[model samples]
Target: MEPDVLGLVAGALTTIAFVPQVLRILRTRSAHDISWLLFGILAVGSAMWLWYGVRVNSLPLVVTNVITLTLQLSIFGLKWRYGRGKRP
Candidate 1:
């Protein structure tokens, strides 16, 4: 390995890790198991990371955080739409 390759691998793993939760929520239309507050925090954090990436010109960081932000936002939307009033 190259550093760029390592970054890509890490980025892929971290970003794709959220896929299962997103898929489950989409398929089952249930986001009761996920915390909305947590997702909101994650979205904000990811946005910050994206900003950092842009400032630092780190392609891996920018790409990964962008994808993660999208996925997390999707989860937040689903939770708001379907998990409203549900506690878990």
Candidate 2:
């Protein structure tokens, strides 16, 4: 496989890895076990990576980070909604 193809595969895998957690949280309407701080940091980091990818003109990085950012933001929203009153 070509390098771009390999990158695309890896990007897709990493990008989609957050989907299960998102779906679980949405279905359960519970984010008590999820770490809000961690997800917050991840979202920020992913955003920065996406900006960097744009600057570097890397399609795989841009695409993957955009997807990851969206998923991470969704989790953040769930965390705020369902994890606010819960204590770890």
lDDT of predicted model 2: 0.87
Candidate 1 Cα outliers beyond 4 Å, as residue runs: none
Residues 1-88 of candidate 1 have per-residue lDDT tens digits of 9877888789999888899999998899887778877888989999999999999989889988989999998888888887877565
TM-scores for all predictions: 0.90, 0.88
Candidate number of the best lDDT: 1
Q: Residue 19 deviation, candidate 1, in Å?
A: 0.3
Against the unseen true structure, what C-alpha lDDT does each candidate score?
0.89, 0.87
List ranges where model 2 is wrong by over 4 Å. none
Can you list the residue pairs that collide in candidate 2? none
Q: After superposition, how far is residue 3 of candidate 2 from its true place, in Å?
A: 2.7
Worst 10 residues of 1 by lDDT: 79-88
Cα lDDT of candidate 1 equals: 0.89
